[model samples]
Target: MNRTPEPELMQIPSQVRAYADADFSRSDSMVVKSLEKFLKKAGRTLNKNDLIFDMACGPGNIAERIAKNWPFVNVVGIDGSKEMLNEAENRLSLNLTKNLSYELIDINSIASGEIHFPFKADLLVSNSALHHFHDPYCFWGALKKLGKTKCIHIHRDLIRPASDEKAFELKEKHLSNSPEILKKDFYASLKASFTVDEVSQQLVDAGLSQLEVFQVDELYFEIIGCI
Candidate 1:
């Protein structure tokens, strides 16, 4: 299926509220666990000064997880939407987790050199972020700019279905109990996401073929490696 790009920022009030309130804990925890597993397999340990960037971190759920898991490492969650970052900051205030912060950034601007980010990441992670970019290269290009050499990557995103019918079926199957707004966004995201093969070619074109892309399940694919 040809990809249909969704809005890059989740700024709408109702949409943001639904997204922030949704229980994505199962999938969010998986991102952190997968990062730990990969880091161990790579024989790498994060130093106290090491930085982890969670790109397009919608509500900072995953960023909070990483900060809690690696209290010594500095973790920043970057997103374009102020509404989203507000949610993240509110959670941080309640959790009182150290070494974690949120930044209001339009990643495409970074990719376009319109904005300069101050920190480079030792570890860069994102969940369901790539599909937001209409041009996939922008996503990869921004990551290349943000990551230090040999930066570890753990990115998971919805996989585009073969057809709209399939996308609808998957959304209904997985999000049947979700709020209407959440389900609508999920369906749009499914349409926006890329196939594993397409993502692999994107990696190659971005001079990041060291990263491996593979389907992790019916709805998602993971990109993992040092890049």
Candidate 2:
């Protein structure tokens, strides 16, 4: 099947509502669980006062988890979607950490050197957002500039399936209990995602060849390592 990237933002009311209201505890928990393992594999540790950046933080779901898990760390989520940020801010009241906040900025603009963030991040993370970029290198460019000093970075995204059958198989295997909206999104994301080799080449082109690109599951690949 040909790859089709979903819209960058869940702007439509129904789409936004469905996403924000859906229960993603299972999948989101997997991401939170993998965070520690990835960090450990990279030989990185977070401090009590570390500043964490969650790029393309749609609706702040993963950001919320990071903040809650690392209660003393300050978390800032950056996204270009106004609607998504609105939903994220609305949910902040339920957060266990007061340090979590969201910023409305075009992350893709980071490559253009047009946006200036107030702080350099100690840790950078993104969950399932890499496939959304029309130009994946734009994200790498942003990382090169923003994470220039030294930062622990990890990005996880779906891996493109070798065939449509494999895509649907993985979706059903992993998302059988998920809501219809999320199930659909998962399939689309798998189509849009890059293969491990493709992502490795992208890293090389971006001068980030040292980052480890590997398959984490049947349908997921992770780009992890500190720079």
Candidate 3:
């Protein structure tokens, strides 16, 4: 498998990040709803005792939701941006329970052994954040380390194509019916997203043969693994 050079660190603009934080906080009816349904269907039990890490966790939206749904599950939301982390901390506080927290950490650094969290997670999850990684391989390596029992990685991002026209078509059709928020998200995601073949090849290169990759929707991908 040929590895692509890691992309540069893609910083989320403050305005965009703020918009995302607010959108996630208020709009729980779409992907978040689907996510809960999916988790239930998968029979994932989040108990208070289990330690779960939300990698690239933005404003702790997913983390808070998970914590609320499974009051017993301990959740730690990790992000690289201090601003996002601060917002996440504030959000976590408002929805405070005993089992949730937030931390600021760079995903790539963690993957390269420059930084370490004290605990190994029972489950490592992220939403729409994987595409932001400057080094996707490092992200995968970190996931490999954290995914001890079950890995339920749900990413609702854009899907790129191997070729130019396919990519354009995907964007055109996908954006046509989407809401404004989704439109912005879709384009950004498309620019940042990887093709299924690309991600599959990466898994193979990473020696992660046990990983299962699925196209959940034209705009979403689900990657699952069992340690």
Tens digits of per-residue lDDT for model 3, 2-78: 22223333245654454454454433334456556656777876566678788887777777777776677788888
The C-alpha RMSD in Å for every predicted model, in order, reads: 0.8, 2.1, 4.3
Candidate 2 similarity to native, TM-score? 0.89
Model 3 deviation from native, Cα RMSD in Å: 4.3
Model 2 residue 84 lDDT score:
85
Q: Of models 1 and 3, which has the larger lDDT?
A: 1
lDDT (10s digit) by residue, model 1, range 41-145 = 999999998999999999998999999999999999999999999999999999999899989989999999999998899999999999999888998999999
In terms of lDDT, which candidate is strongest? 1
Tell me the spans in candidate 3 whose CA falls farther than 4 Å from its real position: 1-13, 21-44, 149-156, 161-185
Higher-lDDT candidate of 2 and 3 = 2
TM-score of predicted structure 1: 0.98
Question: Model 2 over residues 1-227: C-alpha lDDT tens digits?
Answer: 56667776667776677777877776677777777987777677777768989998888888999898888888999988898889899889665459899899898778788987768888788888888887888888887777746777778888898888989999899879877877887788888888888899999899888788889877677777777
**lDDT score, candidate 2:** 0.82
Highest-scoring model, TM-score:
1
State residue 170's C-alpha deviation in candidate 2, in Å.
Answer: 2.8
